[model samples]
Target chain A: MKITNTLLQMVKTVSITAITVLSFSAHAADDKVYRLKLAETWGPNTPILGDATKNMAKIANEMSNGRLQIRVDSANKHKAPLGIFDMVKSGQYDLGHSSSYYWKGKVPNTLYFSSMPFGMVTTEQYAWFYHGGGMELMQEVYAPHNLLSFPGGNSDIQMGGWFKKEINSIEDLQGLKMRIPGFAGEVLARVGAKPTNIAPGELYTSLERGTIDALEWVGPAFDLRMGFQKIAPYYYTAWHEPGSETQFLVNKRTWEKLPKDLQVILETSFRVAAFDMYTQALDANATSWSKMKAEYPDIKVRDFPPAVLAEMRKATDELLQEQASKDPQAQKIIESQAEYLKKSRAWTAISTKAYLDTQ
Target chain B: MKITNTLLQMVKTVSITAITVLSFSAHAADDKVYRLKLAETWGPNTPILGDATKNMAKIANEMSNGRLQIRVDSANKHKAPLGIFDMVKSGQYDLGHSSSYYWKGKVPNTLYFSSMPFGMVTTEQYAWFYHGGGMELMQEVYAPHNLLSFPGGNSDIQMGGWFKKEINSIEDLQGLKMRIPGFAGEVLARVGAKPTNIAPGELYTSLERGTIDALEWVGPAFDLRMGFQKIAPYYYTAWHEPGSETQFLVNKRTWEKLPKDLQVILETSFRVAAFDMYTQALDANATSWSKMKAEYPDIKVRDFPPAVLAEMRKATDELLQEQASKDPQAQKIIESQAEYLKKSRAWTAISTKAYLDTQ
Candidate 1:
């Protein structure tokens, strides 16, 4: 009887000790926190663009129950507005928020991920990215760089530019000094315009001083605050960058280090924030456009004439063809976009376009 | 000395017991799983609509590390496709996936939350919902019902309907029979058309047997499979229910009981899943439309003549005015939507409309 009692007491103590350890280990795993550093191309407090990163960080933290802490460093803090791709790739930053096309000079194929010249609009582009092999293609391009990129947010359709003089014909574009950049600038150059890139702060001064006769900025939401309407009366409609999508970049090493739950939280946060930004952009643009129209009353809304647009389209096609001929990957992406655009546009023509036309 | 030694041993055993109890409680709280039951309006294995709930559950489960478990029951399991509002309100289900308008008879103000005749498109409506006081208005409507409503997904631009003959004038609609439900049906009735509601499974036969002259189903993604293209040669473009947004309903008590982290995960899952459904719908529609066109080259796509459209718009405005006059809440939502639409459409006209026109 004494030996049996001793065995029972020993087993009870061991069971208690084992349960305590198991409970503590599980708590340790659940309670472990992850801190991530993100760098955005936008400056601090930039309206729609900056809001996406902030919103992402906030949601991720809350969703992870304060376990995933993200610190965002905007352009002012990082001092490298255009160097996000390299920063994230080299592990200097764990995450980045910027437009994909900004890295075209370094990785030529990154251009296709953002909006294209005269390409799909916001919904169509999103459909392409999510459902039409766009995400896969984007992954293929980023994998070699040890990074993962996601569609960060859409800026909606960009306005053509703020023009001092009307662009009535291809001849009118000749020798026109305009502050346009990226593939669009290349397209303009091909069509006989003098495409230039100027600092954002210098844009209004340049236009006012005749250093540049015209400039392309974001839509009315972002553009109105710059006081461009006072100097440039003509606000043209979109042709290039129909639906400009910003990107979220993550270093492969940083991503792999994250627990699966945190990874999912981070990605979902990116997606919701991205979609929120697009709606925010649309709402801001609408409200700003209303305010601008009420204040200015003389801001001319013009579409490039059909003939001039045809010439611009031709230039865009030639540039894409040249890129396709040089790289097989480029060819694949270009072809995919072209084919998807053809199919989606037809449906859009029948549905959205048809509805708008009837209205 | 012996009494002090006995007291010390008791203290040691008590400390061990206390530590064990604390650890187990912490583990229990952290590992607790919330299994929510969701009832969807769609039947089992429904495509775009059904995919949303599955995606939401999957993501919520992953992001919460299995803490938030959602069990979705479709119409087949519940046998209450249109009974979601009542079911969720009474706590028979914790969540529901259905369109807001399905509850219009029980709560008339719920009509404004779904698609309106001549309403804003997907992006525009989303902007209104998130930015322009739509969510607040929606909440106000649902607050009295002990439920909360959120935009579940957009079906994109719905087709007007499949017709056996072209609708060229108001006279053509007089005495016409079409299977269209909801607010659009009221608008049609005002214009002297007999609008009928038919069961989904019986729709093909109804149109085929002349029980209905025309029927407005969903877009090509969901329609082509029903073989409507072969029977209805004249497929009219969209005029009614332009962008149909489905809804997610949460029981108030259920929402209040969730821990904040799970709540965020659940809400974010709804958002991302909603957006994903839209893209999936767009891609599916584009692909299906292409296939339908290739197979049925004789299909006629037509827009209602301008005179007929004007008449329909007039009738729609009259009905909305009537509703506004009757209910103060309806008036508020109507005015808000009208004001927002007026401002946003102006921006859209200058941007999206101009781009499409140029193309």
Candidate 2:
């Protein structure tokens, strides 16, 4: 009866003059189109992050032959850059693109999905996500919210951020005010520094007017546009977020409604887009960093002093342990990440690290 | 008239009992399925390399909803592990899976597509391929062969090779007998090493019986199975092939025959599969390296001395400059890759290297 009804519906809709095509596929319902609406944290025309959604939607549409049409609403349209998780969970939007760490207040475990302070690099973390039980842990965290999540894209290795003053020691961070966010901010607070969040629009003015002493925007790619290089003399290397990965959230019900092929297409498109964004970020960083060197020779590149970094690492571990003691799920995720990082880092030390160091 | 004829043909094919269902659409030709035959250069059930082809085929099949079928033929069936280029080029097979450098004898430019001595790592090379001018240059090379090429998968950073003795200096490499194939062999030859290509089947016995003093197979993932760790106590780090990427070849004629959707599906599948293979190699290496460490406590991991690496680097540049002088195309690719490597590596040094070093 369902098949009969679907056939009738298809005949009425496809074309009354083209009934010959209907008999060939008795399961016309399987060919039904699925349209999804996505809300992204980034504004339209945003570089790598925004490009990921557009790239994903285009590929999904072309591969599904227009069966899967994803209507993307950037933050301008959605007006909820930080509320993506809530919107996706509440079914206000069928999908979302945002960094997982944005939901740390609502779901503490969400912080692990994005790059952790001193966590694995991009490829190593990718191995962990796909092969090291990261996806399972991610699902466990999101399942209660009635959402499904995937790696949306990577922003490449995020720089430690720009600093107006050189951090010479642990003393240098004492009562230091910097614009950092989420868990890394907590780590900073624990180490006697004041970490604050500022709106993107006001960051430059805030830093310049002595409202903040330092800031860690994204790496060279995104930071170049903010004119941070002109004000901040020290461009520190990465530590807090080694390989930050953004995520795609799907309303569980919306995902269930998709046919098997369309589901595969949508998921594959997301995976490809995520990898492409990482590659794109790598290129953009390289290009922008080169331009920065040539254009601004005085922008001193610095790594945080060993004493400062060691203190920060200690604080990070302490914070992680505190959370682990309080939450079993957090404990499990942390332990899994720690063990995987040990083994994966060992292998990396031999392959990638060795290659890089020798070169 | 074409629509009328297609409708009449569909009516004649139908049982005539469902005449009402016969007019949905006259373009049944759109439903025609496409089957592609892929020849891989690995025997049945070979590990990571073989899995890439199968993985690609499965994803392409699932996404295409049976509209596209890919039949993968292993080297055991095709009886030509090295003939993939010829078979794919001549249209005997629609596609093929192999390494690009394997065809250096036939096409000198093919060597640059694979890893080079002291070149960019996997992610950097990937950035070069997708964002930089790699794809265009690669297309220029393969177009003449009537084929399209893509990054098939990465085998990770290959170890310099297993050796019976540690290489302390350039003097230690004089007259060293090693089983290192392709352009790395040329580099070895310049360094006064007798680089010989030994059949995979004879490698173990040759190394054990003193026929070969050393050999560089793949890394720990593929190398563990060959029992090299048991025989060669001195395991060296990679230099010859920093990031060995395999190639996926599509016959030009076969590619043209694909529908736009299938073409997109196939291409996306290729990208995902290639990335997946790299992750798989990373995980496999970590796993295998862990196992090897446990079982072979005598195994010693060594990096070539700074002096030795300097000589090899010099040899690599000289050989590259020699190739550039001979072919303008080679010079273009070499220069592009060199330029990309410098910028990308600078970013990597600041980002990935900084992260790794601090850890």
| A211-324 per-residue lDDT for model 2 (tens digits) | 999999998889888999899899999899988999999999999988888899999999999999999999999999998988899998888888888899999999999999
The collision pairs in model 1 are: none
TM per candidate: 0.94, 0.95
| Candidate 1 local lDDT, A25-116, one digit each (tens) | 33335446678899999998999999999999999999987778899999999999999999999999999999999988899999999899
Q: Model 2: what TM-score?
A: 0.95
Report the C-alpha displacement of residue A346, candidate 1, in angstroms: 0.6
- Candidate 2 regions exceeding 4 Å error are A1-27, B1-27
Model 1, TM vs. native: 0.94
Total colliding residue pairs, candidate 1: 0
